[model samples]
Target chain A: MVNQQRFGLSLVALSCLVLTACDHNDNDEPAPMPPADVSYSYEVTVQNLTQGQPLSPVGVALHGDAVMWETGMPASEALEVLAEGGDNSDFIAVEGVLASATGAAPIGPGSSETVTVTVVNEPDTFISIATMLVNTNDAFAGITGHGLSELEVGQTMMMVLPVLDAGTEANSEAAGTIPGPADGGEGYNAERDDADLVSFHPGVVSADDGLMMSALTSAHRFDNPAVKLTITRTE
Target chain B: MKLKQLTSIMVATGLTALSGFSQAAELEITVQNLTRGIYFTPILITAHSPDQQLFNVGEAASTELQAMAEGGDISGLETAVDALSADTVANPAGGLLMPTAATTTTLSTMDGNTALSIVAMMLPTNDGFIGLNSWMIPEAPGTYTVYLNAYDAGTEANDEIRGGGAPGAPGLPVPPPLEDLVGNGGSGVTSEMTNATVHIHPGNLGDDEAAGGMSDISNTVQRWLNPVAMVTVTVSE
Candidate 1:
């Protein structure tokens, strides 16, 4: 708490120094006072809880109250691409996103990643996070349209998230389908083969467990509560 | 040791009620089986003292728990909790809770019963069950959602073959509906109980064949991800 106060004081001091420097250099016409911009910063940390499935790069977004996805509803094209291929490029750029951040690389099982996002002058901010379980056909884990407006600075929120099947692609476990290292196959395909609506993932049926065409093995099996997500308001 | 905590909670409740500060809570609970192929036998939802746990992870399963986890029997558990004057609703869904099905029941808990626990056996596996053990009821009246994972009772082996439903049974109990879905005999999955204490279940290893696989359970149909159950609790004002 003391450190935060000290940091705020130093920022004020630095701004004062900048204003003084401008006054001395441009005495003829003083620089116009910049608009007061208050920044809200959030640090989002995601931990992979699965035994084998590696999480794709985490995508964090600050947006309005619109839900990114819902149960029984078809996944957006951005979500479908990310859930199928573990490519979150379009997901982080979805409409209505005010600010976003993406993890540098895939988070291995039992690993965690932290991404910090900052938005200026956006007080009523809502957070959404999305990431794919790279070993599955189109399985993803995330929370959509969670309100963060009431989260006071320095407060922390934690949640254990459940996995969701994007339903855009079939959980075939077939060769040349999964994009994880276990398969080294293709990622997102535009075709909607399976149930197109999002729902809770039923889990992987690996080849060791009787799926004859599956490229996955028993090690790829996982249960619910696949990720532990933590959010902290830094500023 | 845990029993002492329960006594203290009871005493505190007595004092609060005598001081004219009764905190009776009314709760409406729903349990949904989210698995794709697993079936839940007779669910047991109870609201007891804070320290009274229906089941604890990493601990030994009680005899009552063994009976319920092995077979679809809840009479022993019901009797045990009834002795504590707990608020319980056993088998809200008449019988088996099929895949993707749900059961709802309302419980008006007396003062001091502020913890909730729910348990049910998952069929097609030996001693695999879903559990929510002693979650403290929030003081604020609001709706809360909790997801549950599959647990092993640690009393029986997970040999996925059709066998008796009795405690210490050798194989899985193939109910009438599951008889056709479950396969015939080859050999048992395994006769070993690696973890004698309750733990997270290492899911079933089903095979493709029906009449002549290593086990009877179907691999393609019975597999599930974590969070086999979702419990929604609504605390009323």
Candidate 2:
């Protein structure tokens, strides 16, 4: 009798399970869907326009109204690191950055690099891009506080960038001062032995010019408008 | 636009619309010294007809221009531009614009004046001046930026000495601010004007010694890079 009673209970349970499965039909309202994620993306292309100067890995970031470096102000430590050494790691990681990207390798003279950075759910209004000239003491070429809100998808803007001295290390052109492949010397020294204020770079003076102690040659010299850059919005 | 008036009279005069007549413009201007150490003398900003040029590259500089370039004397240029009926802002900084500083001024141009020019002598160098030659003012109402480069007047020899302030002076003028800043007892940098035509300045070659060096200017104090001046012009329609 007990076994029969248990069998009846099992049958009731099976029917209940079947009815429960049927009650929850496909017609039931689907769980609320999540909102879609939106993204903004940009591509920064930099061309090393010099004849013999190779650029360090390109550093690019989306920032606010604040400038990365000013003409007369002292360079930040992040800027000093990239200017002295050919390292973009610290520059792209600077404070107040929204989104940043860096080129994979050094860009040679007459060569170019294009890097893309994307931000989720918001538009990037300002973009700052910088790259070291690699062949001098603390010289870099860049554009800062460039407004990108006006840039539409597939629209590109072009500008020529002038080289600037970082004012961190002295422009001695000594045998062991430069950190490029041309010199293979020390990089990112903490000493601020130079003018201590950022300014346009005086064209490199080589041993052939007047500085008899310079390790550089005339081939390393460069004039203004050192690089041509184009920024485009991909998304 | 001034040309609009000419266009209206073209039919009565039995002619088509003629070019070269420019519209007057109101401009709010700012000049910033971008150098880390260089100073600028009295700046003269002018707006004139397109035909007038204050200083042209690849040509010999005018004597008036030489006076201003050598001794920071803008009176000659001031008087000359005034004769042309050009609108001007003279010495907006009131004195020497120090390194990495700026000056602002406003100019209301007369009819048919559409070109802009700016000039200032860079101190601590002989015959070295910062110049912008005849940039056409765009008819559009917007802000524009231009960089002015250092130019050699090719009139006086850049002796790097402290000499007279008249025309054909042999050295740079040591203003009060630069009196103690500049060094003495230097022989000279060069005595020759190799390029007697207006040209991009062969940059100052300063020496390390404070006294008795090849140049009186300090290698670290007075040297500068090109594009010494940054000009911003906001045109209001």
lDDT of each: 0.89, 0.86
The runs of at least 3 residues in candidate 2 whose Cα sits more than 4 Å from the true structure, single-residue gaps closed, are A1-35, B1-24, B180-186, B218-225
Cand. 1 TM to true fold:
0.75
- CAPRI-style quality class for the chain A–B interface of candidate 1: acceptable
List, residue by residue over B64-150, the lDDT tens digit for candidate 2: 998888888999999999999999989999989977788999999988778899999998888889998989888889999999999
TM-score of each: 0.75, 0.83
Q: Calculate DockQ per candidate and list them.
A: 0.30, 0.25
For residues A1-235, could you state the per-residue lDDT of candidate 1 as single tens digits? 9999999999999999999887666367767998899999999999999999999999999999888987656899999999999998898899899999999999999999999999999999888899999998999999989999999999999999888889889788889999999999999899998767776787888888678889999899887689999999999
How big is the positional error of residue B171 in model 1, measured in Å on the Cα after superposition? Answer: 3.3
Name the regions of candidate 1 deviating beyond 4 angstroms: A1-54, A70-78, A89-122, A153-163, A167-170, A189-212, A217-235, B1-22, B34-36, B50-53, B56-64, B79-84, B94-102, B164-170, B175-181, B194-199
Q: Which residue pairs in candidate 2 have backbone atoms (N, alpha carbon, C) closer than 3 angstroms, thus clashing?
A: none
Which 10 successive residues of model 1 chain A have the least lDDT summed?
A: A22-31
TM-score winner? 2
Looking at every candidate separately, what fraction of the true A–B Cα contacts under 8 Å does it contain? 0.42, 0.31
